[model samples]
Target: MRRYCLAAFLLLVLAAPAHAQAPAASLPKVAVFDFELFDTSLQGETDGPRTDEHDRLLRAGDQIRKGLAESGRYAIVDIAPVNAAAHEKNLQACGGCDVQLAQQLGADLAVTGVVQKVSNLILNMNIYMRNARTGHIVASMSADLRGNTDESWTRTASWLLRNRLLAPDFGRPQ
Candidate 1:
């Protein structure tokens, strides 16, 4: 009878499920940089770069940061420090500068984008997400926009976030 009781206790212990661990308390941090503008519009007879276009690109960056933060999967790191560091390091257009900025800000991921305007009617918004530690691009998406207006740019960015960045399977190991 004693041996049977011991055997039953061992069997129950072996069949029981192991304890489940709690989820992480904090989300991963991401630093999103301003979307650079590469305007290729034909130089007018006497005109220069359009300041409005630059402003729109800057707004797009803010939109991206907000969108990612709202997703609840990541914590958006403040960009002011990253921008200051970039300026001090003269990191503009430098290779791996985005990653360097993210690392400095103690972020797990970094995002960078470019708005290429070929003309008033043709443009492209390209975004890249990289691992700050490895400096490897984890995701990339591009949207060919038809109009170079604020509404068109905003719409394109929203579509990219929905279809690529915030998709259900996004960030899963392939």
Candidate 2:
């Protein structure tokens, strides 16, 4: 018993400073890209009805971006400037859109997503965050938002932020 207790105390004493000296982690700066719209085509047969679905997805993406940016953890840059700039550079999609361009415009991370239907009225999203300089996907998430309304938008945004940006391990040591 005495040997065990002494060993435990010595271990704790040695580990304390390492724990206390660990530097606080900083939140990575993120820029959100306009979400890709899939399942939202106003086709020959699905034209009229698809308009509502398309609009809902567009709004949801906007709301999610806004909510995530409100956290102040990310240096959120609007997609308008990025898109206009990308057009000038002849980049196709935002993800394939150049990281060097993004970094030169000042962003550490670039976030992009897609809003599509996984089921009836269930909007599913696949979001990705890439390290701008390295082009590595640092984080990714999938979520199902079942309806298109203010409430649904709010819920989806909250879930996205919690799971992707503010995850418990987000600021933790690897």
Candidate 3:
């Protein structure tokens, strides 16, 4: 009986390591949309959007997509197929239109963000993730930026993803 018990214990121990090393289950797919700008400052009011604002918006969306993909947190569904269709309306104002589009792309969640400019000197960047089926927000994060320069915008986006949005405790209500 003792010999039999010892043999079983050894086999269990050997199998445990293999199980632990198995590849992780695939992550949920998400559709990440382009970031939009909401300009509230007087300059934005008078001059319309800055000439380079469109470029900035594209970069912001790319940053979030790259961060999420590199972190292995989500399987990003390519938005290129539906990018033009999405641009037909503003996702920010469409009231869950983003979720519907994500569903059409076979995604489980939809991601969106906006950069709100109070002035050239003050801005806030925010990102939101919503369940495609439920259309409920799953997680969101924001960061305040002091400069409108490219470096500031890029760094803030990265920081928000690395420290807040992607943090282990993120998405849990306080």
Candidate 4:
């Protein structure tokens, strides 16, 4: 009787859920959209060499897209190739900005972000995921890239990837 009871208890425990509430499944096929830059460059610094803000944002976006796709959590569809459609239509925000077009190309989700200057040497960014079918935002996150060091981009990529693999409510209340 004792052995049978112990076995039953163990079976029940093993079958129970680890968390009472968990998201159904991970969002797949995410596209990292363009990183919008809110320029805060000094106006009168003509003497100092100008950094191409647009190029930096594009590099960051590429880094994010590559990082997320490499994680195996998503099938990354490089929207850059199809960006001309958005430009022609002037569909900017990237969140429902091109859901119909994205669906046509067979992407399930899109990741978009913005890079803004909170202060000199401190850049703030918000990265988000959008569902292609419903055209709804599924997840969002923000991080600071400080001092333009190598670690800055690494941290940003890490945060973006973490949010993609793990459900939004995995670590906190939804």
Candidate 5:
């Protein structure tokens, strides 16, 4: 009886690790593209694009990629292969082309974002994730940032990632 008990205990211990690894191994592969900015602010129209906002766009993309990867829910595939196409085309306005590019990268989901600036004080930041094969949006989140400063945008990205972006069953179809 003691030997049988020991055997069962070992089996349970070994099974625990295997079960734990299963979910992580099966996490969806996602390709996160660079974020784009649509500036409609007076500063942009008259004075032309601000260099600072361009840097912000780069940071926003990095933040999203890191957040998703650390969530243990997605495997972030590198989007470098399609970087040119991503930069040249407005992924949001291209009518499912983002999905096609992501699919070519062997990704299960395609992710992109945009920051629309109405002025120095008003901005809308949005992130989108779509099924690469189906070309259907599975998850999306947006934040309205009041200040155009880097701190506000960074904090908003962090908040959105923590609260809505990776929430329970965030993208899974109900």
Candidate 6:
């Protein structure tokens, strides 16, 4: 009886699956493009372009990239290839440009942002995440900013990340 019981226990142990020791799956790679600036402050006016606002939008893009990378849910792919492809293809206005760029970088996902400013006191930031393979938007988030200072821009980016992108229930289909 002892021998039979021991044999049964050994058989069960050998047949059991070993899922606990399995390695964690790799995070998906995401390519984040620079935020495009559309400043309407001088609309219907003769004022020159606001280079300072343009530069600030560019900095916002970098902050977004850094935040996503630090989240550990995604691997941030470098944007050099994306920039090169955008310039070569004149994809600045193309709707699917971001998806194309992400595919070129071998990324699984793509992120694009837009900063639209009507004046120094009123602005909006929009961010979109898309599937590189299917070209479908997986998630979209935006924040309305009231101030024109550097602190306001940085805070908006962080708020978007915390409240939308990195949220526990983010990207779920309704």
TM-score of each: 0.78, 0.62, 0.82, 0.62, 0.86, 0.77
Worst 10 residues of 2 by lDDT: 19-28
The reply for model 2, stretches above 4 Å from the true place, is: 1-27, 40-45, 48-51, 85-95, 98-101, 148-150, 171-174
Error (Å) of candidate 6 at residue 80 is 0.7
| Residue range 34-129, candidate 2, lDDT tens digits | 555555533523643456555665666577667665655554565665665654542225445756556765777776666665444666777777
Q: Please write out the lDDT profile of model 5 over residues 1-174, one tens digit for every residue.
A: 999999999998977755444365478888888889998888889998778888998898899899988877888899989889888999999989899999889998898899999999999999998988898889888999999999988998888888887888887532
User: Per-residue lDDT tens digits of candidate 1, residues 39-142?
Assistant: 77785223666788878878998999999888876788997966866544423367898898899989888888888878789999999988888888889889
Better of 2 and 6 by lDDT: 6
* lDDT by candidate, in order shown: 0.81, 0.62, 0.85, 0.63, 0.87, 0.78
Highest TM-score against the true fold, candidate: 5
What lDDT score goes with residue 105 in model 3? 94
TM-score between candidate 4 and the true structure: 0.62
Which lDDT tens digits does candidate 6 get at residues 1-174? 999999999999988886533332466788888777667776514565567766777888898888877776677888885586654542346878778888989888888788778877899999888888888888999899997788888899889988998898675322
Error of 1 at 96 (Å): 0.3
Which structure is stronger by TM-score: 1 or 6? 1
- Best first by lDDT, ranked: 5, 3, 1, 6, 4, 2
The residue pairs found clashing in candidate 2 are none
Clashing pairs in 1: none
Task: Give per-residue CA lDDT, model 3, range 1-174, as digits (tens).
Answer: 999999999988977865343242456788999999999999999999776888988998999889987876677899988899888878878989999999999888888999999999999999998888898898888889998999999999899889976898564321
